[model samples]
Target: MTVINVNESNFKQQVLDADVPVLVDFWAEWCGPCRAMAPVLEDYANDHAGKVVIAKLNVDENPNLAGQYRITSIPALKLFSKGEVAAEVIGARPKAQLEKDLAGHVA
Candidate 1:
């Protein structure tokens, strides 16, 4: 529920300028894997709370942002810290696996 829906207009302020780490989910509406990853990200956002921020960007709606990040795939997770990408994750994954993948940055 805490996941903020980001678009080209606010991407800079929301993700790039965030005080805490921001996990931006680059996904599309028709992508099956992206849909599957939604709840996992939501759970992560809720659990992490103030430690990190979760943002969802629809590639279909904001192709500019997707292209800017070189998102060739759906469900691409880019962790932004201090205005730069700190980590990246691709494809759909279980919550535990996603957590493990981001452990270093999230912790």
Candidate 2:
């Protein structure tokens, strides 16, 4: 499964009100780190599709949602559970680290 593309219009319903846990990646086209995290995120999307919902939000195209989320950094990863934010990662960390961080929700 591929990660869902999140935008200002879908932010509320997609992440905030998700029935399952959500991993939202805030990224931008010009951001190197953001680009770097894409493949890892894609792997997670495929590996944990049914278990959790993964989304990618482009900060450049959707600044409204990014600003609302206070995403000052590109490639920021936020975990949402039960309609609220549960955890956050603020850099281009390794996939192993990401998995370790979201272990509780996915596993």
Candidate 3:
């Protein structure tokens, strides 16, 4: 599964109302780390298909949503479970580390 592009229009339904845990990557086009993490996120989307929903919200385009989440940095990954944030990962990291960090939440 490819990472879904989320925006203000679909944030509620895609993340908040999702049946599975959702990992929302709050990023912007100009963020170098965000760009670097793109492939890592894609791999997780494909590897963890059906178990978790991976989505990306461009901070530049979804300022309101970013503000609501209090996202102070780019490439911020927030895991949502049962309509609320369950865990968060900031900055870029190796795929292995990311998976390890999210192990408890995703499982």
Task: Name the candidate that leads on TM-score.
Answer: 3
Clashing pairs in 3: none
Evaluation by lDDT, superior candidate among 1 and 3: 3
lDDT of 3 by residue, 1-107 (tens): 85799999999999999999999999999999999999999898889888998899999999999999999988999999999999999999989999998998886
What are the models' TM-scores? 0.96, 0.91, 0.97
When summed lDDT is taken over every stretch of 10 residues in candidate 3, the lowest stretch is 1-10
Q: Which pairs clash inside model 1?
A: none
Model 1's TM-score against the true structure? 0.96
Clashing residue pairs in candidate 2 are: none
Task: Please list the Cα RMSD from the true structure of every candidate, rounded to 1 decimal place.
Answer: 0.8, 1.2, 0.8
lDDT of 3 at 64: 98
What is the Å distance of residue 61 in model 1 from its true position?
0.8
> What's model 2's overall lDDT?
0.85
lDDT, candidate 2, 1-94, per-residue tens:
8579888888889888988888999888888988899899888888887878889888889878788789887789998898788889999988
How far off is residue 28 in model 2, in Å? 0.2
Error of 2 at 90 (Å): 1.0
Name the Cα RMSD for model 1: 0.8
Model 3 misplacement above 4 A:
none
